[model samples]
Target: MRKALILSSVLLPAITAAGIAAAGSEEKPDVQTIVSKANLVAYYQGNDGKAKVNMVITDKSGNKRQREFIILRKDVKDGGDQNYFVYFHQPADVRRMTYMVNKHAQLDKDDDRWLYMPALDLVKRIAAGDKRTSFVGSDFLYEDVSGRSLEEDTHELTETTDQLYIVKNVPKKPDTVEFNYFTVAIDRKTFVPMKMEFFDKQDKLYRVIESKKVEKIQDFYTVVKSEVRDLKKESKTEMEFGNVQYNINLGDDLFTERYLRRPPREAIR
Candidate 1:
């Protein structure tokens, strides 16, 4: 009998069990290798983590709406399955709202998401479609919240600079994606995508996301501040993360539907 090799659903496109080779080393990696590493580095930090996020959504007319939430994330395995629980605290009307996600690394499967509204006292499952749709009326999309699967895009290493690796990514299914292609500039040292630009089929830049600041939190390099701009709409959203702590003990129970209606006080804090 032969044993089959189990592959990590996340990085199978490029990275292997050994890991990405260090930059400037003898073994330089390809675009897939760079993207695979960047995807993990950007999303999967410690086994589990928690953060308080403050978002300010500004419209073209200069109207601003504020939202505050506490995010709890747990990794079932690095570059594999993960779970997220978000509890909204600010903006009196939307207070006590909660969102939960069960993300699978499999590119073919859609992540499971659910939302809870305290005012209505209702929990509804979010249908997966057009992931480009605004999340909570913000410029950030649903895909941005869970993560964009590495396998959904084909990567090309266009250039390499002293501090960044520029890669162009084209979606596998053209009709399924809103943009014709997008480019990401990954920091060579930190493996974080410092900036990204999205272009429509006409090759017009429609959206941009940038990391404004990053700091080392508990030895892990983290993006503490970022912004997303909708060029067509002339709108922007600023996201700032605080009180970040990694490897927190977020139990599996927190990611369940039961918690959607009845959020765990401990997990939110």
Candidate 2:
């Protein structure tokens, strides 16, 4: 087993399954290869998919904030990044405000972000190059959402409970994420992540995410509902997605920078 482990680690993609390829560098499939392929299979299919998301965020003491956000995603172009736009409408202070994310492939490159404040009628651009910064103060960092490469992390198959495959992910990149590691429980049948838990850099569990209501729309299984909890604060955030349709009539103009800056009725085109 040790001999097979050493050879698999050097192969790059199949490093996650070192034991299986122990005998020789003859190229047996590994978990990393499986994960990479599954991600690609799901990634490209959702390009240019638009959905109306209804979010209900609750703070401590059961105080709730409800809002609706429009989300649109575009394909990865020029090996640069995937473009996405968001706008929230609801709750008193944050209605009709827009947020844009320009996620670059290179972690060091600038990930341009902006938020248009309706009260100020001003668009504030968030500067990039803050590696230690969070994504607008969320528990997740910019790299967690933007960096799609699975090779940056080491994945281990922990166990199988009922019908789920629990995989623990630890980042290989130094100081990349604020968390020690996280466990993602994927549905064995669909390869969809059903639940996740994030641990702080101190190796303590920080947050837990549970996803339910998985459904297939336009040939993809999408998580329709999810809840996130902060272990330290006893606060939680719940998000529910609705009108979730996919792979339908998304044109090139839908991904243009002009539309990103000024979203029009033609956004779903």
Candidate 3:
């Protein structure tokens, strides 16, 4: 399951109920279980979901840019492989641009990503190394749009509060990523990740992702608003999700490269 921050999806009520029940129990869950449950709550909502997102990018000097897009996601398994499709709708320069990802659960297999530029009439494959780069000039990275692999890090239960469970994650291979370590505060009842703080190599806090608004949709908890702040750059991106629907039964064919060149009707609609 991918870490959750951007884009919204309908969560499974069964899973949320189970998590709440476990939280009420006297025994505290292990760090791994807690992380796993948080992942599911963040990314794996219903089998398939869709949402329209409006993004506002603010720079250090306070200049702002806006973007609108539609994001579609389908899970092959509840907590394993998945697929994501995103289509741009606003900003004439990026209109009709599309991005797709084939997320893999295996540690050895990297996710496949592609970007479509309508103006250039070109399809570009995004390499694994570039996943951490800014996404569409926004503060959120390509990896953030989907999520980072759980196996890539070692998780520890650093602190547990009355309402939140704090977990610190250190990359198993620190050299591969930018951050030295990150910590997430997970809601005890819903298992939703409320805040995440990233530390640089020098142990300086440099980045943060926060879930600003969460609402229960279709009897499941969903993040409708979120923000990502880049401290060093003094920039931030705020995303608001609307028209979110779950269990849409989206077809797999819609995610193919063929559709990348020409978006499916569902995406444009």
Q: Which candidate is the best by lDDT?
A: 3
Q: TM-score of each candidate? A: 0.88, 0.75, 0.88
TM-score-wise, the better of 1 and 2 is 1
lDDT by residue (tens digit), candidate 3, 1-269: 34331111234445555777878656666787787778877888888899999999999999999999999999987667899998998888889999888988777888888999999999999886556889778999877777776788999999999999999999999988999999999998899899999999999999999999999888668999999999999999999999989999989998898999998787776
lDDT (10s digit) by residue, model 1, range 142-168 = 788777877788899999998999999
Candidate 3 C-alpha RMSD relative to the actual structure? 4.7
- lDDT by residue (138-242, candidate 2, tens digit) is 433445334444655789878776777778888897586667888877776676777788888888898887876777877788777767777887776666767
Error of 1 at 55 (Å): 0.4
**Per-candidate total of colliding backbone pairs:** 0, 1, 0
Q: What lDDT score belongs to each candidate, Candidate 1 first?
A: 0.84, 0.63, 0.86
TM-score of 1: 0.88
Sorted on lDDT, highest at the top, how do the candidates line up? 3, 1, 2
Reference-based lDDT, residue 141, model 3: 89
Report clash pairs, candidate 1. Answer: none
